[model samples]
Target: MARRAIDEGYKVRCLVRSSKKAAFLKEWGAELVPGNLRYPDTLAEALVGVTQVIDASTSRPTDSLSIKQVDWDGKVALIQAAKAAGVERFIFFSILDADKYPEVPLMEIKRCTELFLAESGLNYTILRLAGFMQGLIGQYGIPILESQPVWVTGNSSPIAYMDTQDIAKFAIRALSVPETQNQTFPVVGTRAWSAEEIINLCERLSGKDARVTRMPITLLRAVRGLMRFFQWGWNVADRLAFTEVLASGKELNASMDEVYTIFGLDPQQTTTLESYLQEYFSRIMKKLKELDYQKNKNKNKKEKPKKTPFKQSSKANSQ
Candidate 1:
């Protein structure tokens, strides 16, 4: 998104906690602001001379910063600052059906921020995106690539997956289009697929078998409760919570016509889940080939006969 904004001639300013980590964005023509969303005082200077605000921030379930701090309270602070700065538009990348899942902590937090943005009295564009295919490539695709069984807590349900690149394209469109102002758009993929289907597709693409273990939802809930009671690490507990959310069997499918009508995307041009998974598999295969090359190179080096140093015998020395 930052890159797209820069390519389109927008003066990109990134609010980053670590400037060093964002050095690439800086080199790519983005003005980096050393600020933390948890701290509102730092946002004033960041928002200065800012016309549009695009927030792609989300709190991790396992992170030290709770949803209230970063997603809720921090976003509130950012919105207030943007409003104060007289920002023309605020574009927020939010989760799909955030209000529908109150039991899910992160979803509830998103709902709160969505409401706040709607009432902030500033022009805003809320992009309710489904699961990002790019993110799933790491979480799901990597494990499958490693030949590890992916554990699921419920029946293999269909999930709508969108490419982050497509979402960013729509975001860029929102900035220039007047119709997108003060509107909430469901930015989803053109197709939906079940996890089992995704696994199958990947297996076919890579010519490798993928094992998916479907555990009972009840068991997952029990384990999650036990983890909490026994004080397990936040990362583990949070991952379990996320798994439960996925297992809840809530389909994230939405109308693709919305994107077509709003963002002017041709249905044929949109990326499919199968295509993304194929690309991910190709990347993993490339890495595996590199590893195999390195292994072979090392083995050849070790197997090569070592040359012995020339030495003079006692009889030769006497001669």
Candidate 2:
């Protein structure tokens, strides 16, 4: 995002918790400002001299951060600061059906933030995105295939999986486009793929065998009940809720033409889920190989006996 913003000739300042984490961005002509979204006071300096704010911050239920901290209170603080600073535009990246599913914690928090932004008197553009192809491969790929040929989930449902690049491109275009002001964009990919199709595609693209096992709705409901009773990790509960919702055949469909109409680029030009699966798996394999090399190198270092200095050094010095 910072890269695209910089390429678009905007002065980009990133609010990150660790300066070291964002140091590379500084080399790319971005100002890395140390700040924490969970703390409102830390964001004031970052918001200064900034005309526009793009909020992509989200909180996972399992992480140290909570929905209230990052999604609701943090965003509210940022919006308030932006309003005080007279910032003109605030673009928020949110989840689809955020307002519709208040029962889900993350969605409820996101909806609250959206409402807060709307009433903050700042021009806003809310991008509601569905399942992300990159997210699927990065977060769930290994988990799905680890030590198992089959992964169980709710009934097969088609979800609009947008490429991260497409989302970034749309956001970059929306940054300067006046027509996008005060409008909400339902950002999704041109294609919808079911979970079974995704599993098959992953296997085909990576040349690995895997299977999708669908769990009955009753079982899913029982899982949800357990999650509520035990207060399962927020991430787990969130995933269960999403899976249950999708299994009900709730379509996250979006108009592909809308992306072209708004961003002036054909969605067909972007990467497809199949292509992304290939690329993502290839990258993961490369990383694994690198890690294996490093592990061997470290093992050799530890296993190899350290040589004692030759006693001849004293005799040589005397000679």
Candidate 3:
């Protein structure tokens, strides 16, 4: 996102919790302000003199803070700060159909945040995303490439996962598009893909068979219930709740025609799941082959015997 903003001639300011971890942002010419969503006191300083705010922060399942603390409480604080700062534009990224699954903790929080942003009176653009293709790298791509077990539930929904780069294009373009103000849009890929379809694609591209592991939804519910007892497992339980929604056989997708028309994006230019996976497998396999060739070349050099030195010149003269 910072790259897109910078390329569009906008000065990018990133509110980060760690300056050391966000060093790359500085390299990209983004001014980094040390702040965390968990701390409201740091927000005012970060928001000062900032005309626009692009919030993509979310609490992970393994974070020390609970989802309510970061997503709800912290976001509320940030919105208030942005409003007080007289910010011109605010862009927020959320999950698709967040309002439909209030039973899911993450979805509920995201929906609440969307409402809060709308009523804040600040010009905002809410982008509801189906999923990210980057996530599939760990979930299916790497597992299949390494011949590891690819876990899938009894019934999983087909999700139209968009590339982060495409999502960023929409986000940055929203800053200048008048129609996007105070409006919500769903940004998805060209086509939706199911778990089985993704697994098959990865296997075909990588030339490796996947060890499929299917877990019944009933067992997943039981495990989620068990995890709810422990404080550390609460976030995991919440994530499992959303996973159950995906396994409910409901497709997670939306029509992108309106989005493309409003954002002035060509549907044909969007990346497809097949092309993305194909490029990934090709790059990875080429890298592996290069590494293997280098290893063998070094081994051959080590195994070759050294040539014996010739006799001294004095011995030849005496002869």
Candidate 4:
């Protein structure tokens, strides 16, 4: 998002806890503001001259802060701060079907945040995303490439995963589109893909069979129940609650015609799952082959004995 905004001549200011860690953003022509969502006091400085606020922040399951603190309280504080700072455009990224799964901690917080943003009276665009194709790298791509167990729930549902780049396009475009203001849109992919289909695609691309491990949804529920008992495991349990949605057998997808029309995006140009994975595997394989070639070249150079210089030895010189 920062990259796109910078390319479009928008001066992007990113809120970061550590400017040193976010130095790459500076290289991309983005100003790094030292701030954190959890720390609302610092937000005022960050938003001092900011016109648009694109919030894609979310609490991870392994985050030290609780979801309520980061997702709910932090977001509420940011919205209030943005309103106070006279920020013109606010774009928020949310999970698809968040309102329907109030039981899930993250989804509940997202739904609540959506309502809060709507009532905050600030011009906001809420983008509910199905899933990110980037996530598939950790979940499926790496595991398949490494011949590790690719875990999947027995009732894993299909998810329309969009490339983060494509998602960024929609987000940045929303800042200029008047029709997007105060409107909620489902930003999804051209098609939804199931776990089995993804596994097959990975196998086909990588030319390696996956070590598939399918756990029953009932077992997942039981494990989630077990994890809920411990304080440290509460966040993990909350994350596991999402399995219920997959167990429901409802596909996480929506028609993107309206989004494309409004955003001036071409559906034909949208990145498809097949093409995305194909490119990923192709790049990875090319790198691996290059590394292998370099390794072999070095090995041969070391193993091949250096040709002894044709020396004028006493015996040879005599001959």
RMSD of each: 4.3, 7.6, 4.1, 3.2
**After superposing candidate 3, which stretches have Cα over 4 Å from the reference?**
305-319
Clashes of each: 0, 0, 0, 0
> What digit string (tens of lDDT, one per residue) describes model 2 on residues 1-319?
7788888788998888888877899999998888877778887788889988888777664567646667777888889988988888898998887777777777777788788888888999999888888668643477544635454565656888888777888887887788899888888876788777777777765566764555787786677777766644544655567656567666676776765787687766877777777887788778878999999999898896655567667777889
User: What ranges in model 2 sit over 4 Å off?
Assistant: 143-150, 211-240, 281-319
Pairs with backbone N, CA or C atoms under 3 Å apart (clashes), candidate 4: none
55 Cα displacement, candidate 2 (Å): 0.5
lDDT pick, better of 1 and 2? 1
Q: Return the candidate ranking by TM-score, descending.
A: 3, 4, 1, 2
lDDT of 1 by residue, 1-319 (tens): 9999999989899999899989999999999989988889999999999999999887775567655668888999999999999999999988888787776667777888888999999999998887888877765677777888876668655778888887788898899988899988888887777787777787788888877787888887787777766543443554566665577676877886866777776778778888888887888799899999999999998897755443445556678
> lDDT for each of the candidates?
0.82, 0.77, 0.91, 0.91
Q: Which parts of model 4 are misplaced by more than 4 Å?
A: 305-319
Instruction: Report the C-alpha lDDT of model 3 over 156-261, residue by residue, as the tens digit.
Output: 8999998999999999999999999999999999888999999989989999999999999999899899999998888778878987667978889999898899
TM-score preference between candidates 1 and 3, better one: 3
Candidate 4 global CA lDDT score: 0.91
| Model 1: per-residue Cα lDDT at residue 30 | 92
TM-scores of the models, in the order given: 0.88, 0.80, 0.94, 0.93
User: How much does candidate 2 score in TM-score?
Assistant: 0.80
Q: Which lDDT tens digits does candidate 4 get at residues 1-319?
A: 9899999999889998888889999999998888888888999988998899999887886678878888999999999999999999899988899989988888888999999999998999999998899999999999999999999987778999999999999999998889998999999998999999999999999999999998898998899899989998887788788888766778999988888999888888889999999999999999999999999999988896555546546558879
